[model samples]
Target chain A: MTISSRSGSPGPDAAEETTVIPVVPAQDGADETTTLPPIDVPVLEDEEFEPQADRDATFRPSRAGWAARSAVWLVLAWFVLAFPVNFLSPFTLGVSDVSAASEAAIFAIVGLSLNVLLGYAGQISLGHQAFVGIGAFTSAYVVVDLEMGFWFAVAVASGLGLVQAAILGAVSLRLTGLYFALVTLAFGNFAQQTVFAIPELTGGEGGKEAPRPAMFDSDYSYYFLCLGFLAVVLFLDWRLTRSKAGRALQALRENPRVASSYGINVKAYTLLAFAVSGLFAGLAGALMAHHDEVIVNQKFGFQLALLFVLMTVVGGLRSRSGVVIGSAFFALLHSGHLLSLLEPVTQTIFRFSLVDFITGTIGLPIEFVALVIGPILLLLTITMYPGGIGQQIAPIREWMLGRRFDRHAGKVTEVEVNDVRA
Target chain B: MNLPLYEQLALALTAGVLRGAVYALVALGIVLVFRGSGIFNFAQAEFGTTGLFAAYWALEIKGWGYPTSFLFGMGVAIALGLLTERLVIHPLRDSSRVTLLVGTAGVALAAIGFQFWWFNETLVMSMPKINEAFFMTPWGAVVTVQELITLGVLAVVAVGLALFFRSPSGLAIQAAQQEPVASELVGISVRRVSMLTWGIAAALGGLAGILAGPYLTFSAGFLSFGAVGALLPGFMAAVLAGMRSMPGAVAGGLLVGCIEQLSSLSILDGAVPGAGALVLFVFLLGVLLVRPQGIFVGKVATA
Candidate 1:
């Protein structure tokens, strides 16, 4: 490992430099600087050179090797991104499957929203379902009631999300840590039960129609439309981390007292994070509504909120790719495509339908798989792998980006979000 | 929807006391766990549900007597509490409170999943009440023997906890919570204290579940997220107690219960479909805004 470290870090030179520096300083003052022992010099050199063989072992592929790798990567991207609409699609992705894929994209957006709050801001929101639910209902209302354009409906939904989130932040941001989590939870329940209860807006139990834009009416086009929105959100998230506000939010998360001393407006930046999160959530919700072609209040409940948190944490906090992949995994899990894809192998080997067999044996519902297994994964993520999916995939990501694939490249530092000064 | 104001007030009071007993029971366990662990244990209510499920399986499926099933259920809750402390909480002891809270919630979600797996939604189940006798309150409202039992158990547990705190083991728990390192230096087994705290908290939770189960149908996460869930209300009560006081938690529970039941007034029912939920939301906001610290207790020393 140390020999491999030659290409990545400065271990070899630093050790030699340390030994030589003490000896050279003896010229300044022989009494002040103690000379190193003669025996210690060879031992140090041998220690530095012991792992020498591995320095040449580190993989650095040739031009042709790079070309092959890039070609393979290109085909993989094409298969994932475009093959479903093209004739070469596997698994025979039907129209509903395409719609389900759109849901996956939208879920990625939602997961990113959560990453901004829970990961970047170090704030917990168990009630985030209300944020998305409101966005979906608001967009549905704008298009159905006000006869607005699709973009206009989306804009209005985003605005409402920002406004509501700002109000919530203003009212309860003073409540730090778990108290704030409790407040948001109580508020979420209130919104679901009361604010959403109004028939004019949420349309009660009957639900409301949420039609797709005219240009993106087909399932394939709508899926791309959602993909386009996901790209926009991803771009915004990238810009956020690179901006001054993002840095300030990170500082504040580290220590609000110190951040305040440094002249950062902790409250404003927190509210800003909240608003940004709300905007993305609202946009995702709008896309989800149109993708479903209808919206209902019941779909946005405590379980949905819990699932949002699950996907975000499991995606690897502060990692866009991790969040997206995790969200997509869950979306497929929920849609049952991932399970159905495994049906062939299970049928041939086990000689029975896996889903039906489980349902028959344990009486667990199909959708409950995420609920049952998600928390266990989350527990594992928190305890054994703090960086989650992002950390696991980081080596590959770095290798693709022309960097040495150091095993610890994406290791997450301690994110102790306590009122205690850690 | 047009009942007399006096009748509404009377019914609200009666309903509040009965409902408040269960909330008090749940709140006491929550406060106990928080004091011992310095964490907002979100799985507190789930403990009750676990016990309820255990007892239900024993009674309904195994055809065991009520007393044996109840003890088995309490035993299950204790085991779960021990597993949680050892497996989840102990491993993540250095994690932030947020991470710890999430861990507890994960424990809850896993338990809920197990419940759903073993007892699917297809089975509609309810435990038998302790008694079938009904009594009339002066408010013209009906009172059940089960409710009286719940109230009696709450009283007994509250007094018992007070006395326990004065005992040697209870003092050990307090020392462990306040000065874990110092207590360890002095030869107190802080680890054992943690186990003891969780076990007792879980036992209290088990009592709440067994006593309250007769009032509603049993299912997965029944005590945590069901229609008869006491989780949110229990938290509210703990908050009202400044997250520290024991007796304060009891009083706060009654206050919240009455406030929640007040939504059952005909006027409120006529105006809103889920008046109880709306009232709880508004009242929680009002209390937090007005006091922030607590109504029943002095300033909280820690977060």
Candidate 2:
């Protein structure tokens, strides 16, 4: 018996999908017939062979599920927009708390800026504070000395950031891995000690004043401005990760030599990333300057750079929502607002205020709490949960997007970021 | 005490040499770890700080003898090295080098935090030098006995390392580092080699700390970011060594020290604030661009 290849789907007889018919050739010198299983050909119809992805794509959430997701979305939106403004929420945020919220938004922008370099380009900057500091100082200089408006100052700062970062990127492009990191560290030190030390520029020890925009003078309005900037940054970041340049960056990050072999201009694309990162950082720095109403050189220290790296890494690289959340969390913690927010809960649960426990019992100042606890969290994130908070909240994010809840949906089997080539 | 320009230059050179010895010690530890494992250990300087803090605790807090405290500090540094290797490094051995760098940095931060917490009462502390006397150089530079001791120890360490590499265990470490699979086939315990290298490197870092601790009043991150900052210089030296040659590291350390001191020349005094850092930054960029394999190093290192 011979098996024939069929062009169409098998009929009712296709129940036995795999029919192993053994045949013995008549020319065999064996007394017994040796069974040889023939290859079973799959008779699949062209129109019927749909992939699992297509099935998932065809899925539609029930009306009730859609209603639930929309409600949750509304709550989240209200929490972000109206809670602080005391519009629809019962709990009211104080003036200081609103200011802290603005800081959080700025931090989120900074985190995304770092994410572009570390997560996408696979370059680490230990002196990121330098970039941010330059931005702040630029904005302050423009506003104070040049008598520029808030918007013009921010624009100048961001442009300077792009120019400076591109220059630094060009210089360090020849180096990679730890060597590049060392250069950034040195540059940071240089900027801190030499550049920031100029009395005329940084306004000496007293620092420079950066007034808020006229319309956004109040803390509440300023917070909305920050949130609006954050939204713009988030949009830009989302666009970046989906573009051709972003693909090139991801390629080079995984393996620069391989990417170069494929005709990708590693240096050009890396410089683009640096410019973009710098632009965002400068914007953040300008916002930060107005937020504090007074920007000082002392604010941009080595510790702050490390904190930026920590929040970005802990927030999970390459995850937009996660970075925003992580940056906000750290900002709130740094402002001491997070502890106050959880004061009542800690009072009930642990029988003591958490801030008092950290300050009095643990003998650590409130200001240093993030520095101390952040590193431990960083270590845990890198070792055990490489995906970080983003991975943790992935299932819920997917569920809200009208997909079936998958516990392991966004689980990163291995860290997407790779080592810089020597 | 204002000397002529040439005399001042000579004095600066003399002082730089004395400071370079400590840098040499730190560079040695950095080079050792890099050669052992393909990692840029950010905690190398922090290891020194930890050791210094431990010695400080032993001496001032516990009222122990100087020699005993020094040894105890070395022990603690070695223990921290082993702990870091076992806890953070070993588990992520197969991960990318950047991850390992981050891990080491985390370890350093944690240690710094612990120091800040434990030694919060004393913001600054000083240790007595081995000898209290100072000797004036021909050019009028006053050299302390402690500086001479540091230089002497660095010479001994350099010679000792040269000899150690020819020994069986040292050779085993070299073999394991070069080719782990081949070394394993030859019945070498790669794990043990890694542990020994880390332990020795930590000890070297500890020695640098103990010797330099007396040079200035120390704070939490004494050798890292404090008054007697040596981490950047050490890293510069290691890069100058191409991250592989031990002898090159020693030579590189001295050269870096001299170059850094050149910023103190009269011409650069008011031209730039923090001119030393500017010089170092420029020098680093030049070296990286011109001879990335390092000035002292001849051959390319196997990555």
Candidate 3:
């Protein structure tokens, strides 16, 4: 496997002319001089010399290639797995499927957005779920009480998210790291209280329902809808990371001071990053509202915020695969059937049902897999394999191919390596 | 709306002072952790709730009764704090502040999970009545025993902390905070000092929780809210003390408490139920903008 390094700076050949000298003590009555050995460097052909070109040729695929090959393969796999479950399985494709998939999509989007903030921007936001909650409530109000169409509700939700992020970004840009986290946390709690107090708008603890579009009444259609949104978001994310703005964002993420010195507008870029992330999160929340047909306060609590953060960290934030893979893994865990699979084993070993085992083991309600699993996974990832599963497997996959998995490099390059150090 | 000016003023002042005391106690716990470890204790409220639950268990489950249960609960809380510091905080000593913060959050979540597991979902602790009645005044204002105790506790803790800081161990802790390597050279154990700090902080938080639990409902959710409530006042206290001065933290806590209470009683009555939080946000913003260091002191570098 060929590994290409990005170019540093080009400079004149000063190394050849430089001579090595050594100093000796005056008491020794001798001036010591040493000559350095000449360096041996490999000379390569023009084809081998062009590393960037070689890397690009090896990895970058045309749009048509992905659409025709990867897209088809993904679709086939989805159908293969889903067909049996939908038709042959005894379980009904009712609220469970819709809830699980929708929640996963929402979390995935939240994770993706956080990748830009925490993963890319090097900023930690403990209150990011506040934006998600805001988006959910906005869409719920629009779709249910205002009787707006689905698209309009989504658009409005995204718009509100943009505004909220803009305000937060402006307020918090001056603060660094922990202070920024604190401010955002306060804002999140404030938002939560505001939502609670405005019972007229949020329906208080009772919650409000968001009617789904006529076309997506069935679980299959709803799942596809969610998948479609996921696909678009993934594409947008891919496109974003490739653009000038994306590179600039990455630069700022690494070192805002350095990026600013290089003529990048730090504040503007930070605000833009926050807004874009909020937009995607809002879209996800809007979809969640429609899919669940309910907007409850409990769904967007602080615990959920922490869960989203944990998912992003566990998913190898900054890589599309990391977010998608982590989302799917957690989604399956959240499903009741997955938990039910352990019932017999738990019953035999612990003399308790799976639910009891889960409750005892995690010290929380068994239903709260997201809470228990998210934090534990976060701790495990940070303490042990901070690069996460996607990162750990990437090298292995490349090694197995022998020719290097260059095609995946572009998506993986954005993953923050420094987080692993922490 | 048409209340006499004198009555309105008295009510605002009394409410501010009472609320301020609660704020101070909560913030004091945060101050202890921050000063000793150089890390913000996001789990302060959770720790407090753990103490509350322990107290609940002693009183309700073990049938240890009120005052004894309270003492038992505090003892349990101290053990939990020591265990947490040893297992979680100590191992993460060299990690980045961000990682430490996130780790504390995990600890907070775990604490909540434990609360959920031990306590029945629907069970609520019947808080002992420490204060039964309020003394009415001609000015249409009343002072309750609960308010008095809350303020009294604040006073005692503040004074006690000041006195402790004057002791040899306190000096050692101060030195440890300033220069751990140097302090170690001078024959101080940084680890022991930190554990002591954690134990004291947790104990303070537990006391606050036991005192406040009767006022607010005790539940698994209480920790999350309680932590948040503690944040602003505690943070303000830390900032005011330059994050280094004990007196500054105390004064800052009292100020935050007063502002929050006054805001809640006056402007926030029916208009904004989140007036306390709003006031805190404003105070934080002001602190950050006008004097990011603090009102009375400069920035004190944490370990």
Candidate number with greatest lDDT:
2
True contacts kept of 2: 0.52
Q: Is the docking of candidate 3 incorrect, acceptable, medium or high quality?
A: acceptable
Best by DockQ: 2
TM-score of chain B of each: 0.95, 0.96, 0.89
Task: State the lDDT of candidate 2 residue by residue for B192-242, as single tens digits.
Answer: 999999999989888998889999998877887677678788888999999
lDDT assessment of candidate 3: 0.69
lDDT of 3 by residue, A1-422 (tens): 11122212111232221211111222233334334332222223332445644453355445665455566565556543464236555444555655576666666777788777876667777777778878878898998789889889989998998888888888778776677777877777666766545776667778878888898887667777777788788888888887877878878766677778989898988888888888887887788777767678767667667766777777876666677778666655655545655566677788887676566764556566655566667666666555565675564334333334443432232234233221
lDDT string for model 1 (A176-287, tens) is: 7787777777877777887778888888898889988899999899888888999999999999987888788778887789888989998899999999998998888888
Residue A71: error of model 2 in Å? 2.7
> CA lDDT, every prediction?
0.82, 0.83, 0.69
Query: After TM-score superposition, what is the CA distance of residue A253 in candidate 1 from its true location, in Å?
Result: 1.1
Total backbone collisions, model 3: 1
Please give, for residues B176-244, the per-residue lDDT of candidate 3 as tens digits.
Answer: 877899999989999999999989988887877777677656677474564335654666666666556
